[model samples]
Target: MDGVSPKFVLPETFDGVKMEITGQLGMIWELVKGPVIVPLLQLAVYICLLMSLMLLCERVYMGIVIVLVKLFWKKPEKRYKFEPIHDDEELGSSNFPVVLVQIPMFNEREVYKLSIGAASGLSWPSDRLVIQVLDDSTDPTVKQMVEMECQRWASKGINITYQIRENRVGYKAGALKEGLKRSYVKHCEYVVIFDADFQPEPDFLRRSIPFLVHNPNIALVQARWRFVNSDECLLTRMQEMSLDYHFTVEQEVGSSTHAFFGFNGTAGIWRIAAINEAGGWKDRTTVEDMDLAVRASLRGWKFLYLGDLQVKSELPSTFRAFRFQQHRWSCGPANLFRKMVMEIIRNKKVRFWKKVYVIYSFFFLGSGQGAKGNTKGLKKFPRIFKLPDRLNTLELGFAAFLFVCGCYDYAHGKNNYFIYLFLQTMSFFISGLGWIGTYVPS
Candidate 1:
């Protein structure tokens, strides 16, 4: 006591003493994670369960649809051919109006060269083709690179114009709208939109232009997206199979049957008048492409899904990139549900079955949530083992039956039928994930 000499003492009610005590308690609570932890866990579990059920239902529905579609759908054997436009002189002589090719980009430096090269290589008359580079890049390097590319192409007398906005008002959709405001775009009778990543085949215009010329009411033509680097990795391979199934079978069948076919964002040509009448591209959702298509359909503007016309684009090479793309797509569908679903259902112009298909397709966006659910539910309820096991058994049985039938058809010298059946079976499951993954992100 003599050595301590009345050590300094602070009252519990003093500000410094109170603050020190409270800080220590806060640290202890932080380590413990407090009462909200249990509630957050509960909410998460509920979300997982709901998503799982939705995904399960979607997959089951897709499985059934694949079977029905295959059984009833028949490919049109008689090919409808269009006269080929062989040379620059022929293209120039053709009475078809000027076509505006708008290529929109945002930080796509890696793929920009290939895309621009593809555009320049398009088999269309240089005089009639107007190429608008809608670049929205804050990065000086990307801008400089694109500007130089544009200049190089311009020197070759490829009617190319480069434009960039001061700010991206609504991302891609805004950039496209701004591009349309240019006077050069106003002179065009049709517009062909391509993403920065796509490399369209040289004959794309030759093949697609004829369709618009033949059909007066046709608003847009969506060419199938084929992955140029599907075999790059496991993810890319899976994506390739998925796209093959989608473009080759599902979209073909859907369009042939006059069902609701969503407009793919790229590799498509649009009639300028139809787009104007349908109110151009709306930026209400991230997927301006689909939104525009649906609105155009609702307005009685027809769309053509050209199965034979292929536009190659790079699939996301990594899981993270793929996941981001999927998330954007999923959220877009949800947003579309709020924006267009009710109006579509109410519209007298759209057929009843088309509205139903729109609902079905919208549900397709929720499929990733289903994958998330399946992964979680399998972990949570071990009894759910029966679900996947049952599905596997059913899938195996179906495949086996098809194999036997295919062999029988081959023995009967119905070789085409046999091959068709085999391809159908293979594509059915391969493409089925599009619907399943909508509800399950994983």
Candidate 2:
């Protein structure tokens, strides 16, 4: 006490006072928590239930929209269909309008040859078609392979150009824009794009270019993607189902309803005029394809999705790759959504429905799709003692039927169940630390 400062020394009664206060607070907490804890839990559960209901209603509305679309949605009629080997006399010359085929590649050694070769083999008039391979591969060996492949195609009398940049400044999108700068590309009226892995059919140019040539207002002709390795594994199969829905129901609905749908980047043709008008490809967001499409749409350009024309491609074989792909897919769209929503709303050219559709889609289907739902304590149930197989099937079927009447999804498929299982397996909670401060009751 003699060595201690007056402020540092405690009163003789401090210990007793502290003990009494602590005990009193502990007793109060116990009493409050007993009465409060259960109701708080019940409140959380109720909130979860409400969110689930909202999600279910949203799904039903989507289902209803899809059904309505299927009942009566028609794509535009082709004024003139393109033939691979044959000539179109009405298109002026045998070669007709020049087309620039751009293949953007980056460390795609495994699939570059297939894409380049396919692009070369595309049955357009030899002189009229110009194939551009935009290789941004850091791997010198891969870059050489791509160049050699281009040379091989060129030697065979195919009009192909191999392009490289000192730096991948804009990555894939930058490479594409650089490819368009060549002197030969100036004559090209329309541009067709394929990702490095996409193995488009020989008739790709013929099938996609007709719409562009026939309709001056049409800015892009997007083709559906077909996964060649869809049967390789469960992951690919699930992706296949999901993509099938996207191409068929979602795009179909978008086209029919005149709501906004976007380019898949690869396997789509863009008019050079439209590209120029829309400010070319800006790498402001990860999704340059969709960004370009939206801008073009806002500029009074129409996009046509050809459902009948399918371009085969590979799906991500590994989960790590798939997760990265998901990140890009989710984050890019959301980024673009954030960047473009206000612009879209303010744009007088964009239809009201289209704006709403884009907003809702970016809000609900962005990264939020991966956020698992309100199963709560249901995950603790024994996995081994599941419902009987037959009963499970019957119950699922009944649920599906009931949902169909109200409009929603029931887990009838094995993959659907697997997804639920995956979600359960991955669930955990982290307590967020916050400051405990005094507050007045509102």
Candidate 3:
């Protein structure tokens, strides 16, 4: 081999040297097989068991709550009523109050126009609406696009302003803080924040503004977000279902139970005064929205969850983008736990059950049987362990019931529920592995 060319040969001076290329290759192969593989295989087994347990646990909890609510708690007989404004009323009277809509952008050139157009077309008095393009784009192309869009809106008599900062100090949070300091938004009554990917309906303000108007004590109103292109792929469809579960069931249930609910960052309106009173936005955690919501709620500020109003946003269509989003969410919760859990527990204003839910929500950070289950795949079958077979028959029955219900919800539209469930279970296994992938050194 050496006679062919020196270039193709190992250095002659290092001839006697024994290099552990195989060892390095073995390390690489260990990623595919070794302690990591062993645990992952074990995790797969435990995941099946834990999933069964979780199924049972959720069903029992939900059943108990339902029975208690029905037997003891009196259901509110309140009915929703819509009252449209009269033409005779002063345009300034009930028509339009000062509303500052803040659109936060970061490297979102692809959806910039759609977001801007949707915002500009909001059905509100032009004079009363102040749209601030809070652009923190490091890319010149994105910056130019934002400027041009702002100019176009200005020409059309829309009160839109473009803002750019030299450096992104606190990322999205910093952009918002700096924008708030600007005199333009100081006197604004309410501020609506939208991420670059969100395209709110024209009547979003018309629908949500009244809640703030009628309820003076309300600090924020969060509208449900719907994905516009959810049917684009299997990944997006699953995401849409997950989001539906969150907004429709979890958020509503939490709000109705007077438990802690969070601002989802975008598609929400905050009273400028309420934001100021809650100490404005802070950059201590990656989930600035959640941090602010919790701080404000603990500070005696009330939040309204507006179920009727909906804002449309794009879902991450690829597994890569979805994984990135989930990773950030997971890390944000971890960071929040580090920063605020103790303070939350110590707060006298938060209710006991709310504290429990907060604790439960933060349990995702624990290295428990659940985490292990989440990290494994079923492909390594036979090794897949059943969650403790010692669970009482009643517990197993309850688990089966809950599993069926969750499966029903997830497979509502599918013609073959079993296939759908299998695919979904596999996708989750893969995604969970992706989550664990974050901890691996590159």
Best-to-worst ranking by TM-score = 2, 3, 1
Clashes within 3 Å, all models in order: 18, 0, 4
lDDT of each: 0.74, 0.74, 0.72
Q: Rank the candidates by lDDT, best first.
A: 2, 1, 3
Better of 1 and 3 by lDDT: 1
Q: State, as a TM-score between 0 and 1, how close model 1 is to the true structure.
A: 0.68
Residue 299 C-alpha lDDT in model 3: 76
Q: Estimate each model's TM-score.
A: 0.68, 0.72, 0.69
Measured on C-alpha atoms, candidate 1 has an lDDT of 0.74
- Candidate 2's error at 73, in angstroms? 3.8
How does model 3 score by TM-score?
Answer: 0.69
* Model 1 / residue 137 / CA error / Å: 1.1
Residues 268-360, candidate 2: write the lDDT tens digits.
Answer: 999999999999988998789878988898898887777889999998755435545765666677778878878888989877877777666
Per-residue error (Å), model 1, residue 257: 0.3
